[model samples]
Target: MKNTILRFNDAVYRLCIAVAGLSMLTMALIIPWGIFARYVLGSGSSWPEPVAILLMVVFTFFGAAASYRAGAHMAVNMATDRMPPALRQGAAILVQILMAVVCLFMAVKGWKLCANTWNQFLGEMPGLRVGVSYLPIPVGGVLTLLFVLEKLFLGDQSHRRVVRFDLVEESEGAA
Candidate 1:
């Protein structure tokens, strides 16, 4: 059961990472084209700016969730690190609970925002619904919530190293 859950978590993490990476890549490509078209071509394309903004939204939210799972998100651990083991554990639990509450709030409010704006269309991209862009809010929230639950029930999987290297083996192979 534990292995199954961990596997699922790993899959989700990888998926989020992939989505974030693709969003960034698309934004990078689109922005330069937008600039070139505006200056060099003497006319700016309407699609690039809005598309880049949408991609950025996707990148930020999904990237954040992935970062949280990998324990790479910004945190001030100065106080917690100084505490004794028992106190540290207690503090960790408290923080996780608080985080869970925040995620819940995000999920609820995000969904409402998404639903309410479903009828609205983007000015630049009329085919795209404004509400579609807001989807990452609730999706990211749910992902964070799942990660918190995994930590609270199963244990911290963040410390598990995804990569390792052997210098000796590499040197021997070179020789």
Candidate 2:
């Protein structure tokens, strides 16, 4: 059962990373084209800007979930690191609980926002629903919530430090 849950979590983590990466890649391609169209071609494209904004929203939220799962989210570990073992464990638990609360708040509020805007359309892209753009907020929140639970209960292997053999080999060759 634990293994199954861990595998599911891993799958979600990979999905978040892939989606974020693709969104960023799409934005990278779109922005340059937008600039070229506006400056060189002398006609600005309406689609690129809105599309880029949407992609950015997706990238940021999903990337955040992936980062949190990997324990890459910004955190000051100075105080916790110095604490005694028992205290450290307690502190960690407290932090996780706090994080869970925050994630819950985000999920609830984001869903409400998404639902409220369901009937509204984007100003720039009339065909697109405004609620669709707000989707990442709740999705990211839920992902983060699951990751936090996994860390709290199952232990988080994602944050473990790892040495890259390829990087080590390259460095040795450089010397």
Candidate 2 per-residue lDDT, tens place, 110-141, comes to 99999999999999999999999999999999
Candidate 2 collision pairs: none
Candidate 1 lDDT for residue 132:
97
lDDT of 1 by residue, 16-124 (tens): 9999999999999999999999999999999998999989989998999889889898999999999999999999999999989988988999999999999999888
Query: lDDT score, residue 66, model 1?
Result: 88
Q: To one decimal, what is the Cα RMSD in angstroms of model 2 from the true structure? A: 6.8
The alpha-carbon deviation from the true structure for residue 119 of candidate 2, after best TM-score superposition, in angstroms, is: 0.9
Backbone clashes, each candidate = 0, 0
Candidate lDDT values, in order: 0.89, 0.90
